[model samples]
Target: MENDTICAISTPIGTGGISIVRMSGSNALAIAFKIFSSKNVSQESIKPRYFYLGNIHTADVNEKCMMVYFKAPYSYTGEDLVEFQCHGGVLVTQKVLQSLIESGARIAQGGEFTKRAFVNGKLSLDEAEGVIDVINAESESELKASYGLLKGNLHKEVEKLQNIITDILSEINVTFDFPENDDEEVTSADVLEKLTRAQKTLDHIIKTSTTGLKLKTGTKVVIVGKPNVGKSSVMNAMLGTDRAIVTSIQGTTRDVLEETYIYKGVKFNLIDTAGLHDSNDLVESIGINKAKEILKNADIVLFVVDGSQELDNFDKDIIKLLNDKKVIVVVNKCDLKQKINSSILPHAEHMECSALENKGITEIKDKIYNMVIDEKVLSQNVIITNIRHAEALSKSNEIILRVITDLQAGANLELVSLNLQSAWETLGLITGVSGTEEIIANIFSKFCVGK
Candidate 1:
């Protein structure tokens, strides 16, 4: 299957300025030349990486297009690659893909191109994941983290740690083969010191997962408050669009409203739930219950309160619900005469805002971002954004810790070598060096076709 020519519509299948149909394999250029006709270019004369204007000759339709080729060993998949930039439209792209398929190019599966790259040693497993992350990134922070992976930041660090292990393993092997030589025998102290360093490196990388995950998956910011407290308005003000209904009448929003916005390169998922209060209406009551449920799972709760009105039983009731949650007490309606005391919500960070006038919204965004994401952690170039990488790193760390324990307990060097080798292979999984076919298939299955 890896030897066959593969093709797919690389660009999104919809109307746009242009859409690219990509192909890679030994027959990529042959398949492209079979269907594409250019005035001055032939398969023998077409230069690699140079674009040529041409007409796509299919059975029923002919369309003007542009074509480019990448020679083998220099292309994205390290094989002969070709791309046809056709007029952007649903039918046009599909027809182009079909034309290629009819011309002996097999349809590329989801992430097949990238999978080929990984198989050809063009990318590490983590770097291939980074390519997908870059494609699906929702915010600047996500893009930065994914780009770091594409640039081989995490791979470099992992390689360094693996090198340390390799050195120790080599010494252990020599010690076993030549017990008579004292210099070749690796001492427990020497192994412990090197393993401890590797452990610290792994620990630091694992710690970044907390903030790294938030960057990849936006922070969940749920808005909860008494009715008509500008909860919906605050959501609108933050989003710069009126996504939720806002009315002077209480209980206007009877269900949860959700929207997402990017602030300072970080994505924030704003969920405006039904106001927290006692209600007789069955639907509103259900929504209130759901709001309470969502509150428990929120990354940060924006407890909105109408500053124009004094703290009432409804406000107090909601405040008590935010027991140990990471919360920001949003005293909305600050333009009106202040009546609600911020000091009442002692458990949360307090900020005043006038959603109607769009005042203090920036401060709210900054505070939320600062509260959740640590700038210091993000400053570190390598972060594990993918959960799989984190899991593998954690397992490798555990194995290394066990090896340390065995050494400390005066276990045999041969047994210690076995654990060390296991740790090395576990780390290799992150780079695809020791990953099974099933794991690799599952990882690529999450990718969209044409990736």
Candidate 2:
């Protein structure tokens, strides 16, 4: 099955300047030469790693295109590969792919090329996942983290830890063979010291996931306030566009409005819900219910309040709903004579902003970034952005901790070795050294078709 040639439209399926149909495997070059023809190039004379101007012949159409060949062991899949850059159109690209299939190439599955790269040892599982992350990144921060993984930073760290574990296992084996020799025996203190060092490394890596997750999935910022308090205005200012309708009428926004914006390389998913106020209208009441629901799950709540008005029951009710939440008190319309007192909400950070004038918006953005992300994590070369890697590392850490506990308890050497080996194997899963086929399949399945 691995020897079969595979092909797909690598570029997005749409009208563009060019569309690329990619192929890989032992027969990629042979299959490409079967359909491509040019005045100066032939199947027998085509050079590797060079593009040839040609025409791709299909059953229904013939189109001028550029054909490139990559020899095995040098291509993305680490196999013989070819790409046809044809005129960008849905029908043209499909016809090109169809021609390849008809010429004995199979359609590549989602992420098949990258999967082949993984199988061929060109990239580790996490690095392959990082390729997908780069493709799907929504913010600069996400891209930076993904690029770090793609460049093998995490792989190097994991490899280091695995090496330490392998050494410890070897030591344990020696201790097991010469139980009577005090010089060869692996003491509990030695194992503890080594495992403790590994544990510290794991702990720092795990800590980066907090910021990684936020980068992968933007921080959910829910804006809530009483009617006509400029919640929509604040949202517009943050997004630099009018995403929600702004009106003087109370309850104008009866449904949740959501938008995304990037600030300082971080993505913020802003959700503007109906004003939190007493209402008899059925639709408005339903919107209020949804607002409450979204508030409970929000990463940060922008509790917008009209600075021109004193604190009211509506504001008090909304504040109560924010119990124990990471709240940012947004005193909107600060350009007006201040009436709302800031001392009332001491639990949350207060930012005075005039949304109408776009005043203090940058300060609010800075505050949100500081409140959620640690600056140090962003500067680190390796961060765990994928939840799978984080979970695997967490499991490995747990096993190592248990091994440490067992060693401290004076457990048998064999028992400690068993736990240590388990930890080593668990770490291998992140790099695909010991991962199951099902796990590998699931991870690649998340990738876009033709990746």
Candidate 3:
């Protein structure tokens, strides 16, 4: 938390086309200038928020790079920041960071830059987490959900609830002090009605967390069937790559093969498992057992079947195992005449595809994605993608409901105000601040009565 200038390799550690080294703090520009030299460029002549082509002198070599300066109060960390975009290489980037460190700047810890942003009021705690999500997002759906938080959607909602709670607490306090023969029961009823409305709002937000969590963590879709029914081909066709080995031999996929693909901005974990049939070999048996266990945890199961063949005992057994799970019967190899009856597979979505020919693969992805996500429903709502945010909302809802119940049961104004104040403070946890000052400010600002 020191104001000392901190530096680190901004880009990922590796040999690439280009790499960036970054520094932030009060002495960030000064420390950077110690090792960087540009023609006609000095501290007095430096322009803030502008890039300067310079040479960074290091213990090992001198690297020609582009350096940009971000002055305090407008930078990412709300302090003087500098970035050196140097030639991409492990040795070059490390040397640039080393020179800054030797010139009196310390290396930055993981997430310290963003944490500093939060500490300096550039971002709230939830928004800070959103920054991490955006950095780590592997799929488009997850990125969209992360942007919702980064854009202050949840923060604004929480502030609204805090304002409501502030108003209620202020009203109760004013009524208690005035005591002009007010109807106590009527006032309590009105407070109870307002609390219920906030509770419902919180309930709706908590409900969206389920989908939000799925977006954050991609759905696991396990594909299981008897071997040699083109399960590997189905995987390769969907991914447009030879991710799994395909052969005409039975039990080719003796182990679980997992890969990920995005369909309509949502990520799905495609798992190819060993054929679900009796195997004499111990290794094959273990693989079959593993596939069965994976199905239990899968968000969705792609129950594959040979479309040109009739139902075998193995297919029936696989169907029975998926009785309680979300399933999509993938009638694969449907280029020939269809022989597999869809009616027998009850309570499952049936989709036909010829994996060998890549026919209907897109439709199956559409079906799997549609089965898990409904973008239309979430289009207008702010999703609670973070577990901590969801938990805070849930805890606030619980406390508010309790206060409502106590109010209905004849709790006095003083007692109800205490509980309501607690609820307001709990809601403030999301934004990393308490409501004591906020309540005092609210009372004076919203009410015109003499204080």
Candidate 4:
């Protein structure tokens, strides 16, 4: 561990009942003794992991507070650590941190503490990233995926794959070392079989990323259709709130309205766009154009139509755009007599609903949730939410495939082993076992100061 002591406010710097100033390093205990004194424990008698009621005597003020200490090799940073629980006010926490800094503790950079923990072998690279995800998570599903990473399951799986490659490489090397050891003779078929199986396992992981990425970045679901199709009513019904301006008049919503809702633990960005139609008015034209633009980029498009009215040219034009798109034809206003024939819609099963009655709204939500989330992978808890890990896994899988091909072509075992070594190193990028300092620094730089 580094010898320089680092300190920061571990809690949010705002009004609360309590705030913590954390310090970690070899000199943390020495620095704490300079400003904090408790009669219950002396410098030599201070117990590790024991709380001590103390008074922080600074030049500006002598504030009474509580302190706790943790010895090296067992703390969060795997070094000596101390925490001072002070008043929750911003000034109080800042003064406490400044006092520690004046006493020889330097301010911690963003995520230095967790980075040190990684350096000290307390966590893998992916697990450290999980820590960040947990802190910034907005939904239960995001938190669940983050916890999976933090729990080290993904690291363990990668380690197993790496070990398989390592064993194969060792077997290949043994054949080169002892040519007469016929039992050690590794056949190309054997190597190909093992690598192929590993490739399949890795491929499944990458496949889940299609939906896994959505867990981190909420799915973009835009509800669009012609004017007076009850698009705003659908948005309100889905959100269970009067978010968008609901009016019977056509083109009332002359702009895109966006709101977020959690469905079955996954987060979704439900966007209600202006009615898509030919517009002579300038502002409505702008909104219509904007809706068309975003519709091109949406993950899911809810093509709503009024069941009480037949499809018009405006609806046909919008349908032209919905082709080759992931769409749900919402034949809204099912409470009235149904006149719209949903069979004419080319894509997706048309969902009939009355937005005013809130009928079928729950079913629409269920279908939306089911469209993007892969329940099997989420149930297995092996989602690849992090883009970095996904890319690394992909690179490794590609390298392994090339190795399999070279082996099948009767290439020399030495050449095959070299490609396998590359695959191993690539997988190591996710775990930090064989990563460069630049990647590590870049990852940690994104974390908050206290973590």
Report lDDT (CA) for all predictions: 0.91, 0.91, 0.83, 0.91
Error of 4 at 405 (Å): 2.4
Q: Summarize candidate 4's per-residue lDDT along 325-383 as a digit string, tens digits.
A: 89999999999998976475666767989999999999999898888988887776678
Better of 2 and 3 by TM-score: 2
Q: Show model 4 residue runs off by greater than 4 Å.
A: 1-3
Decoy 2 TM-score against native: 0.97
lDDT of 1 at 301: 95
Total clashes in model 4, counting residue pairs 3 or more apart in sequence or in different chains: 0
| TM value for model 4 | 0.95
TM-score for candidate 1, please give it. 0.94
TM-score of each: 0.94, 0.97, 0.88, 0.95
Distance from true location, Cα of 398 in model 3, Å: 3.1
The full ranking of all candidates by TM-score, starting with the best, is 2, 4, 1, 3
For candidate 2, the C-alpha RMSD (Å) to the true structure equals 1.4
Write the residue-wise lDDT of candidate 3 on 108-138 in tens digits.
8666677677668998777777777887788
- lDDT per residue as tens, model 1, 209-323: 9888889888999999999999999999999998999999999888888888998888889999998888999999999999998899899999998898888899889988998
After TM-score superposition, what is the CA distance of residue 396 in candidate 1 from its true location, in Å?
A: 1.8
Model 3 weakest lDDT span, ten residues long: 442-451
Clashing pairs in 1: none
